[model samples]
Target chain A: MATQQTQLLARTLLTPAVALLFIWMIVPLALTIYFATLHYNLLDPGSESFVGLENFRYFLTDPAFLASLQNTLVLVGSVLAITILLGVPLALLLDQQVVGLSIVRLMVIAPFFVMPTVSALVWKNLLMHPVSGLFAWIAHLFGLPAIDWFNDAPLFSVILIISWQWLPFATLILLTALQSLDEEQKEAAEMDGASALSAFIYITLPHLARPITVVILIETIFLLTVFAEIFVTTGGGPGLQTTNIAFLIYSQALIQYDVGSASAGGLVAVVLANIVAFFLVRIVGRNLEA
Target chain B: MARMVTTRHKVISTVAAWLVGFLIFFPILWMVLASFKTELEAFAIPPSFLFFHWTTENYVTVQERSDYLHHALNSIIIAGGSTLIAMLIAIPAAWSMAFSPTKRTKDVLLWMLSTKMMPPVGVLVPIYLIYRNLGLLDTRTGLVFILCLGNLPIVIWMLFTYFKEIPKDILEAARMDGATIGRELIYVLTPMAVPGLASTLLLNLILAWNEAFWTLNLSTLEAAPLTVFIASYSSPEGLFWAKLSAASTLAIAPILVLGWFSQRQLVRGLTFGAVK
Candidate 1:
């Protein structure tokens, strides 16, 4: 009876958080869905009417939607590839007995903490500006023409800035995974006359596999909705060159005040994100057991 | 277990690692240096690495022009307020789940995690409309509420992970000694949970501080935080590099320090204990 009472108390304790989260998750989502089907525009309030699937049709057929969709994929894919590629080697290097390991680690991780707006502005104005930027200065020394980063290649510049922010996350997680690897296993491989490269391929790489997947999934979740960097630097512009789905929806709602179509675009983003989240939740769920 | 390696190899690895570290850190270092330079010198050709005539004029000008302290204070309140509120709700939920876990506990936890996966953009339209109708747009209260909900899952999950590690034996011992539930919590659990609580607070504060999307979308001048403050510099009109750098530096410096201290908690909180 005492245990039963405690269990009831436990249920009571859990209710507030559960109720709040449920309301938070469901209400806005339901409204978004409801509005997606209406002819709602902030600019033309009190005129909302049922227009089933019209917003979706318009959003889907729009040229900007296709371009933004493509940009979204490329942005997520390229940033993931760059971070993981650089991160693996960086993690291995940090895992070694390097001099001043803490300082070096801190330096590498510093970029991750810089706010997206600061990093984006710093990159655009101080580093990537064609004539007065650091890259231009460097090019001048090398006798090469300066490339206007935002204009010449907008998407790639966004990727580079984002990759810098996320590289530390991947590296830090991979390093944690690396630190947990058993020394005896590597020693055993050495005893068996296995080459260093072969041992890494067989043992080390396998240990990092799970962390790498976790990194990829988590990064994908954030990367799909990269907003501030694009907002600050490119404004999704020089033509929809850098406008990922998040920026597209942002522009649609705030810039153009088209709530119905933006809601439709928002749903498309949700579906895309959910596909990634499904895999991520499964991975995290399995890890919960361990 | 120590493995023997040649001094030469170690030296080579150190050099290579530092080089990579410096390359990664250069942008932030450059920004900091640029903040101290004159407007004319900030955009100097050949980009003065360390030899620039340093000045505090940019910092002064940035503060004077934009009222940097006002937005900064907003950042503090919003980030701090949201984190405190989230912790308040999350602690009891996490405590119950951690200590008195039932058959459905795992599912409940996973479901909370799933809510985090719901993209903010998915609800952007409704939130905007709701805030507009309620006249809550450009209010710190609105941003705080949204940010709190946004981070509550991670806060609860982190607290759950921490609370679960506290041995149940202690609580049972206190119960046998005739301690009431309230007394048991105050006397026994609170002391053990303090460090975990501190780290969780630090990590959540950092996350909330750097949260840009909602803050950007929902806020304008009245309640704008550092993210919006820095973004206002995007439009180029004149020699604004030094001033922009000054604002950016001020915006990031506090959180960057907090972030460094909470690096371990960050990995665990963000990865949901998958990596750690």
Candidate 2:
């Protein structure tokens, strides 16, 4: 039996959360939009003036913007590719009967739990340092030159570190999906004399599609704004070689003290993320009814 | 012949899985090992795999030299405080949506999730400026406020999903018995909802603990958590490999244990119940 009292109570219960999130989302965003059109610089006070679209124009034309935009895309795209490609096989392997399964799963998933700064610094100094890193030592053992990771291929290093962190996430999701698969369906496939490869191509991957999409969308949202790894490892450098959009906006506002340009860059990032969010919201929306 | 083949198959796959797992886990394992070594041996060329003179000196040095406990305490307060507040705010909202179906409930949930998608950097400038003007920068209160808001959507979503699973029949049964609403919550609902609430709390705690952007941007020293504290080592001073390893080991050890416990809930919470 529906009652007006219950509905009113429900709205009352929801009011605080709704109102708080509303303010949290709107206030900063409104400020960002307002700040974007100004010539605001924290360093030089009282220089604030209306500079409509000039900040955007400068930010759009800046070489750092283009490079960072490319870096952001490459970082996101490469990590996605690596995680999915490796995750599928890893998930499949884990789904098999294995001794010490729990321990293996823990070990496999351990890196995702490591904080970004710790992982980045560890990889930088402990394993990737040219002169003394484990990788260098291993190369030296083979009578090869120690390849400098951060200096030589900073973006690649960042990509590799992030991929390591995300691989566990992809694998864990895919594995969960794989575990739920009907055993009878797999048996039915085997009875049809389906080769393992064919069964995987047909039964396994198709079952995995939804979860894979979930993994991709969720990971993309986080990956597109990967800041901590870049912050600690390269500081967006060797030059601007490893700067992503998130880090780019950060430098503009905080380091360069250019709020107007930073706000514009911030909106650009919001637009890019919203494009991904559009698809994600649709998918999650569809699932809400289920 | 069939049994032998099955055994062989399991053996080969297990071996392969272990190899890959070890490879994936090698970096973290190597770091943990380095934490146990002396400064000279931490980054020594031809890195020692085993049989090194293990020492606990780095751990002691890291704490004594750098006030590790202070940052650790900050992490506890910030993460713990945010999780508690988010849970408090979210539980009511999630409970209402779960119990009372409205035409707009779906829209509200999706809208909330959309807020999370707005990249934090998009609003970093305003937040920084606002915090500065309000004198909230470098304060645990500011971190808690921001993080609580940031994670509220997730908390609500997770709790909503969990609450939705509690069968409506039981609550109706309790209502029909003339139990008051408050009594119904305290008696019937709380028991079943406890697991969901706990999991959501654990997962949100982990997320807040590792959050870097706002913490890094806003807090300098007074309120820097282990994330900021560990990042401080990334400067030229990061050359102290043993100390870095020791600090990192301490930083991740608690969360890793907590994370492992909450892995199942993590997938559900992170994916917004999309996969589950």
lDDT of each: 0.93, 0.94
Model 1, span A1-62: residue lDDT tens: 87998999999999999999999988998888888999988788799899999999999999
lDDT of 1 by residue, B1-276 (tens): 133456777898999999999999999999999999998999778677788797899889988988999999999999999999999999999999999999999889999998998888888889988999999899999999999999999999999999999999999999999998899899999999999999999999988988999999999899999998899999883389999999999899998898889888888999998888
lDDT agreement of model 2 with the native: 0.94
Q: Counting only residues 3 or more apart in sequence or on different chains, how many pairs clash (N, Cα, C under 3 Å) in candidate 2?
A: 0
Deviation from native of the Cα of residue A146 in model 1, angstroms: 0.5
Q: What is candidate 1's CA lDDT for residue B97?
A: 98
Expressed as tens digits, the lDDT of each residue in B78-161 for candidate 2 is 999999999999999999999997999999999999999999999999999999999999999999999999999999999999
Model 2: clashing residue pairs?
Answer: none
Best by TM-score: 2
- Regions of model 1 farther than 4 Å from truth: B1-5
Q: State how far residue A138 of model 2 sits from its true place (Å).
A: 1.0
Candidate 2 docking classification: high
